[model samples]
Target: MADYTPNETGSQLFAEKMWLQGALITAVGYGAVLTLYVLAFYLLLSRLDRWNRQAHAIFLVYITVQFILATLFQASSARFTQLAFINNRDYPGGPGAYELAFFYIPVDMLGNIVYVLSNWFSDALLLWRCAVIYSTCRFPLWVIMGFPAVVMMGSVGSGIMYLLQVSTTSPFLPSSANFTIIDSSISLALNLMLTIMIVGRLVVYRFRLKTNFGLSVSQRDYTSVMAMLVESAGLYAAFSLFFIVPFALGSSVENIAFQALSQVQVIAPFLIIVRVSQGKAWSTSTALEITSASEGLGTLKDKVPMAQIQFACASGDDTSMPNAISHHPSVPNSDTTLTTEVV
Candidate 1:
């Protein structure tokens, strides 16, 4: 409540303000993503069928867990901010120093842990989608996913190390910085590779459709550019670059990007789930269907026949009439008698 300005430089105050701004922006972003999660959850629940119930249930549980982790991270972040700016505002070096010195508090630790967990979930889901999209490719699943799987395991290890390092010391310490950089770089690499794989598969699908079925079919449904972007989780990958680049470069802007990256990660997968619930996402059978349809189009058109039927009614009180049905080759002398009652 007292008007006391700490002896900090203008740049230090500016950096602290950036951190606060990032938190506010993250809160707003979380609200929007939460709305999307609710919509996706409702769609998944309402459209459950015997055929897809098991798959839908698995997704339902996955997204629900993701939502819980994101919610906890956000709550812990808000609590830590409150403690720094209000409860300990009068600490020796001002609120910013208080935040830095107490970064290893329980609430902050929880936020870090959940944030890492959420990232791991999002990355795993993206990798799964990539496998589904590329199911019909000539390469074995292990061949396609092998390197990325190793990198993902490395990411998990680095994330655990990062958490351990931060728990005992300030995140600004050199030891914590090494683990932070390694963890973030691995995550960024994993996301980029998965996004590229997914988008690449969709692009190939589009090309095949265009070549075989014309441009119209290629530009519609799952192969469309927008659909590819959404299904590939491109939004998350792009946002990760925004965060990782700045963080790797030691820029203060990383603070803002870091705050909202987790929410974007969740939003990316939620969008994919929405498409899946709508029956428009790419599936294991999609490539096969496209191939079969392309190969059979001419045969189907040549073999199928069009039929015409004619109905006649008596003008007077007669209730019996004969109907003439005709096929493409013309069925001669084919007629059926009909009886009708007028009410």
Candidate 2:
């Protein structure tokens, strides 16, 4: 590698430095979010009033992928750091940090594909919950199958785009990180709207069913659904400013802002989703207030969660088998849950 004296000015160097700063920030933030998410997920799983084992398992997969992707994207930041340091100074190669920076295109591109697919999968998981939520309503079969089929297409398209870029002569698109923001952006918008639409339909159908049954949709039910939607909206918000400031202006500074914006993109959703579900918010709400009344908070004499209650009454049972079998109901702060078992 031959050294060539560079004529990059101070402003150019500062701009590069900021992108590196964003990368370092991403590395640190990704590690922190992954740690907190794991601890929080386990803590949530321990509590009683929550997503069923099936839904919880789906979430387990979703969050796990999210954590891995964030870590990879952060790892990709090292190249930016090198680029920043070598900007004004003479280094080897035409692009002093090409060896370092070159890998970023695929990293960003693959990460974005997985990122989008995971969103679709997450929403599909939500739809699965909807199938459960509206099972009683007998939500039209078409809607059930149709909504998810459409959503899956977006996830598929995202993957195809990634494969296209990977298999092409260009491993990384020279600009825009080889993951076209335009296609990605349109896909994201379509997804958010799709989720909102599907959820909106669920809400309507839910209320209609309740009305027919001479029962109003409970505040608790509404709260649970709203909480889920909030997660989606929060995710969309993460990418909101990125497109607005950077590509909207179509300037290099905007591109620089775009780079930092990418870090925030991963940071916000990872924190919001992982944190909210950590403590099993559904089961532990104060409004439920059931277990709180128990003297030991429902713990047995030995201070365990009393899996089964034994009752031996005066009923005539010749085999010495008890007349009653009672397992401690998994009521939480409240004596009631949505009763997913029944539905």
Candidate 3:
């Protein structure tokens, strides 16, 4: 047992309390994200026809793997909490110090590994989405993705260092702390870049639509603020910023953020998959259709008989309009309903 001043004992007690609070928050968040995961998974399986089987299979596998990782992480965290507060409460320097000292233990190490894996998978998904959204851009895919890919590799390297150091030393030690900060900074930077790219692409598309067609209700469905946030995984990025800042500062607030981060990571990509399954997510065909319509607006109006035009803008497995065009309120009501091919 090591000698501790009164202040040190008080600080350890506070840290233990914070850890318990963080664990509660993690439990709640895990339940909510699990619900979302299930819903997204079911929707994808049910709507296999929306996308190619290969794509659907890939998404299914990705989410399944993520789920497994998250589950293991949560289990490890719970086990550690049990050991720290219940099993080892009387450990020298209190439960909090016990947690720090025993971080290299198998349970805590498992949690750390899975946590890093979750970040990697989540970042990779965001990068892939950015690439898909910009696939039609003048720049080559490699050009746009190359830098972020390199940064991701750096994040991986730093993560490995952090893990290795934590396996032999306390994470609060300077050696492990440095790697932790580096890994987190790199991951955050990558996430922000990918988010900006995706949202920027959608914003440009929205502007083009508004400029070409004036204002239409259907256009909002595709490029609205809510759509942009969801598709870009902006929520995750925002939460990450909230967490990373405090974590880097060595604030206790990081405990809460850290606990919830794994769940949020899963939730972010699950939301995207839900949108894709519902045919509301932007796809290559959707982009091409919008571009064709915008470029040939006048021609379409002149060539197609107005009386023959009927807008079918319903969402969910509807082939009436390309994905993302939910409804068009711009068309004037007429006594005669007609059918015309969408441009």
Model 1 C-alpha lDDT per residue in residues 1-343, reported as the tens digit of each score: 9856667877667667877888898898789778988998999999877468999999999889988988988898799888977898778766677777887889999988998999889888888898898788898989998998998899899999989987877665456157877888899899899888888888887888787666445347878888989998999999899988887777767778887887888889988998998888999988876665555442333443322343345454453543333233543322211111110
lDDT of 2 at 142: 65
Residue-level lDDT of model 2, residues 1-343, one tens digit each, is 8855356655455444555555565566566666766765775466425545665565566667666665655555554445535653345333323422443356445544544444454445444544443444446756655755675575567556755655443332355554445444544555456456546654564465445332233433433465555434445444544544454444334433444444444444444445346532223232223222222322332333334433343343454654222233443422222221111
Q: Candidate 3, after superposition: displacement of residue 65 in Å? A: 0.6
Q: What is the lDDT of residue 249 in candidate 3?
A: 80
lDDT-wise, the better of 2 and 3 is 3
lDDT of each: 0.78, 0.47, 0.78
Clashes of 2: 8
Q: Which scores higher on TM-score, 1 or 2? A: 1
How many clashing pairs per prediction, in order?
0, 8, 0
In candidate 3, position 48 carries an lDDT of 79
Candidate 2 lDDT (Cα, 0 to 1) = 0.47
Q: What is the lDDT of candidate 3?
A: 0.78
Model 2 earns a TM-score of: 0.53
What lDDT score goes with residue 171 in model 3? 69
